[model samples]
Target: MPLLDATATHPITLPDGTLYRDTVYLKNVISHPRMEIGEYSYFTHCGKPEDTAEILAPYLGHSVRERLVIGKFVQIARGSYFITSSANHPMTGFTTYPFRIFKPETFGYKDLPVKDTVVGHDVWIGHDAAIMPGVQIGAGAIVAAASVVARDVPPYAVVGGNPATVIRMRYSPEIISALLDIAWWDWPVEKIETNLAFLETGDLAALKMA
Candidate 1:
């Protein structure tokens, strides 16, 4: 049987061949206009499949200017959520209270600068991780559980803690560059399957040859 099915909302089949309802392919479940999700990006949550976008990013409204862009093969564990630019209060003022929001016609704060949140391909976000707005997580990055990521993460970095800091780079600069160049995630599924051994084993030489 083929390993990946892009159309399957519940993609993970258990050992007993029963579908796991807690995980869903984000692309198949999410239909938000402000969000752009790549194929095979799965989000593990206990919420309804149709509410995946809302649960993942509660503050990203349909009318919001900023977008949530998630790339392919990303694995997001349960309890992880994104705090988009829209979630920000009027921090520039003396009082953080949003007085303008009380009136229907004067729902201000539209002028607040908003930036998109981007998650790169093959990233693994751990449980209860909180990604702040405008943060760009590079491909193959691993965000530790309960992390609060406020800054951009480099490719293949392992980050942890509040205001997440890079714990370490998964590979040396030379190897990281080569992997980025290889970009196996962009390859056809069949080709990827054929080279799965190299990917799983971290055989860079073999992958380069593939």
Candidate 2:
């Protein structure tokens, strides 16, 4: 089934097979490209008619694109901000402060390094969360509402605050690694859609047996 419908003039940016469960909604998805949503993900109230996951695509200008690379069973309440190029600034100048003052003309930060932001499966990024550029949220991570994530999160960890810090770990390393190795989420789309019933029952082992 289609995760979200699109207008004839505006197509939803989701890739060929994006599954869903519980409550999931993506209002508009134009300009968003290479989108890959997972199970139980609900993204609502998209910004701008033209804004899309493609917003993450790199460009040569002062402005940067917005990105939201969510994973399976994510509960992103509302107003979660994900910026792909928010990290770069003019590094050549004597002082980085000057670049901020210059606004659009900060030329020194050209070709700034870029890293892909990864959101792990079974993540619960609460409402109004702001995931900074280059942050990789590990699997089963929980980012509390209104928290600002500025660093990498470990698997099954909980983080919250302005510059979110790891307050706790939700699982042992062994289990987390086991789940990662299982990688059920990476299964082919048609297989998932066809075997939806088995998955609903939580018997992922069936995938292994098959």
Candidate 3:
């Protein structure tokens, strides 16, 4: 049997053989116009499945210009959320407060510079981590628990703390480049399954050959 089922809403089965409903394949649950989610990207949240997109990105409205693009195999732990560019208040004026938001007719911040928030493939975001607007987290990156990521995260880097400084790079630049070239997340499931040993064992030579 295949380990991954793209159609499954509740993908995780606990050791007791009960379905773990808190975890869902994001692509199946999210139907937001401003969001683009890839396959096998699961998010663990206690909220209703229908509200997954809203819960994950509260600031992203249907008419918002900025998008939230999350790539394949992203594992987002419980309470992690993204704050998109739409949430930013205008900074050019004297006050940061949004006066225009109070009135329905006048309510607008459309002129504010908006940039899409992107999460690359095979990324793992730990519990309660918050991704700031316009931040691009690269492939194979790990954002630690309770992090507030305000800047771009490099590929294969482990980051943590407020503003999310890089704790360390998971591999040397050469290896990282090689892995990016391999891009196993883009492979067919059968090919990925066949090469699982190399991936898990960090056998670069074997992976290259595979």
Q: Identify the runs in model 1 with alpha carbons over 4 angstroms from their true place.
A: none
lDDT of 2: 0.61
User: By lDDT, who's the top model here?
Assistant: 1
Candidate 1: tens digits of C-alpha lDDT, residues 1-210: 779998998999999999999999999998899999999999999999998999999999998899999999999999999999989888887999988889989876888999999999999999999999999999999999999999999999999999899999999999999999999999999899999999999999999999
What TM-score should be assigned to candidate 2? 0.60
What are the lDDT scores of the predictions, listed in order?
Answer: 0.96, 0.61, 0.95
What TM-scores do the predictions have? Answer: 0.98, 0.60, 0.98
lDDT order, best first, reads 1, 3, 2
lDDT of 3 by residue, 23-103 (tens): 999999988888999999999999999999889999889988989999999999999999998888889989999999999
TM-score of 1: 0.98
